[model samples]
Target: MIVSKVSKYNTLNDFLKSKTFMKIALSMTGCKNNRYELDQILRWAIKNKVPVVEESEADFAIINTCTVTSIADRKSRQLVRRTRNNNSGLKTIVFGCAARAQKKVFEEITEVDVLLGSMQEVITYLESNISDMKKCDDASLITSGEAFTRSRALVQIQDGCDNYCSYCIIASARGKSKNRPQKEIINEINKHVANGFNEVVLTGINIGAYGASLTTRPDENKFAELLEAIFEQTGIKKVRAGSLGPEFFNEKWYKVMQNPRFSRHLHLSIQSGSDSVLKRMRRNYTAGQVTDVIKKLRGISPDIAITADIIVGFPGETEAEFKETVQFVKKNRLAKTHIFPYSERQNTLAAKMEQVPVKLRRERVKKLQEVADICRSEFIKSQLGKKAEVLWEHSRLSGRAEGVTENYIRVRVMGARTAGSITSEVLTTENIDTLL
Candidate 1:
């Protein structure tokens, strides 16, 4: 099941044009996974006007997928085959979390000529010399510098994870926590700034843990210092960081946030608000610590859009624990809550603990959704009258245009669409689409 051999210096642009005007198509599913990965590839496609044909019309389709859930895995498989059936002779590439999670069987798909994991490698493979693309499980190793779509590129400050959370298989699949050198990060940020990207988000498997293993215990290269250097040295106007953990919070982080250009967005992963559940899930922080951080962020910048990831229904989650989670959100008044039902990933701590019936998991998720809706309603109410910068995106509403507020809220405005332009601000609390 060996796919085509990718050459040593594969770049996505070079790969796409290697075949002479191939209509490349790509799609992504899931939360930040969607925004960070596919957004980069598609943005590249749009910028180059590289004949990135839509799913139905594509000659060579790429699926940058997810494996967060068994259901998500199903969707990835379905999409892979669907693309194959639709374009019978067309070449398809299936990579990303699901592809890795499901074994190297994707190379079995006769129609899919190439499968690369992680967005970082996928981009390189696309532009890489057609012969250099290696069909290996290590997507990151397929390294080649890409121009990205913009000058302000996401310099992956880190990659992989060490925490090994109970329900997540990311650590095993992606491997250990790996951080690019501080100087390397600064250089990339400088490159992005020089290219014209005013903002760069420090990204990785567990970004908040940056500098921990790199420096000695007493004189560490702190995450905060990394931020300071990125700002003071690189002069990148906006700095956003995450998949952060609550344990990483310290006053030094407060010092970094004092900078106005540091985006007031904190994406905290709160699997559940119940303490017993947190212990069972092996999450290091309690609900209170998470709240304290949220409150601190609000005090520092009230407009900060605080987002969270919550997984409901572990092995033996009871109604009381579920209620506690609901009450936790009610008290925290979270700006946004990403709700997920627990999925039993193979070879994880949770899968072996005990099984929560599928029906029960669904019910728990439904209840949490109810609570999340309540929290979102309260947060939106708080956002009533604020001026926020929004990045405009094309719309499905009328094939027109829309934009996203800094806190990640979508605000539909009256204007023509431009792909990457940051447009004017509206002095309204809620966006037009909210009412619709």
Candidate 2:
């Protein structure tokens, strides 16, 4: 079952046609961008007629890992071991941020067949193994970074991050900011539209920083402008913008988001609610700036879903600073907040500072989490009797169809099937799912 040595197969086409079909298991743990990258590899396997199996049945396994936090790093390592242990005959190949950041960590594991830095390594591996492989013109269709659900597709418009937040390791792992050409992004979404995807989410490592390094002509669109162009030029009905920083929001931003085609939901990264913590974390925006942006966004769309990321216990964070965050969250009444307890990362400024005790960090996270729960509950309650356009993604065991609203609420349609997107009235809020 060990399919590591591809000498037996001449080409991918030949392997597909052979009696013994190779079983490849692909696993990913990280952000939307990482999922999109892994999806490309999955699509590639499907196009070449490779049989993808579960880890238990895998002949070879491909793991796309994350190392955004210490917990993520541990999980990535555990996943490597688990994959190998599941099938002793399976060959493990590791890639993505975790592998890039800790190459030596993966190299020491005897189970890993290959440690890769990028998707190009996978392409090279496949191409090298093939003898009589005929290059397919549509191969890029699979390789293009896109993750699809039944009615929605997440397209990676950009990759990597330039903002080296003091606690973040993404800069080291993902490297400098790089944008996919505007033409390429448009074309990819066109494909998604053609394939019956009702919605497309523009995702990236640092999405707001799009086109920072690119030399643009006077007429060309940058981040917000690019969004405007997409709405005007594309056949896409619903376009969901990705995670943006507070600095990205402005008059130009309001102009672009005014389009009805844009989703009312936005994920704004607000690392800390305290200006002092913000400064220590090297975040570009201040607490006051974040509040202003939220207030402005609400002015535009009163019911707009504004989710944020908040790091709870950074080094040197005092009780008053933590309380400042709580007050901010309560005041903003954010739709949702991702609360992460500070975890020290290597080669980061915050890591070298006076560390906060784990117990205190957890206590702050618990307090913040309670606030997040209340915020989420209030948002869902607000939508109790309203109607929303739902893109049905999956069917549940209880004869219910679950999907997400344009405003990012996870809704379950009772007795609904695998039907496409629909505009339906919200029946009840009794069974509303809550996550913090």
Best by lDDT: 2
* Global CA lDDT computed for model 2: 0.77
TM-score of each: 0.80, 0.89
Off by over 4 Å in 2: 1-21, 132-148, 214-221
User: TM-score winner among the candidates?
Assistant: 2
| lDDT score at residue 50, model 1, on the 0-100 scale | 50
* lDDT by residue (tens digit), candidate 1, 306-384: 7788887788888898889988888887777888878888889889887778898888788777877877776666666
Worst 10 residues of 2 by lDDT: 1-10
lDDT of 2 at 74: 92
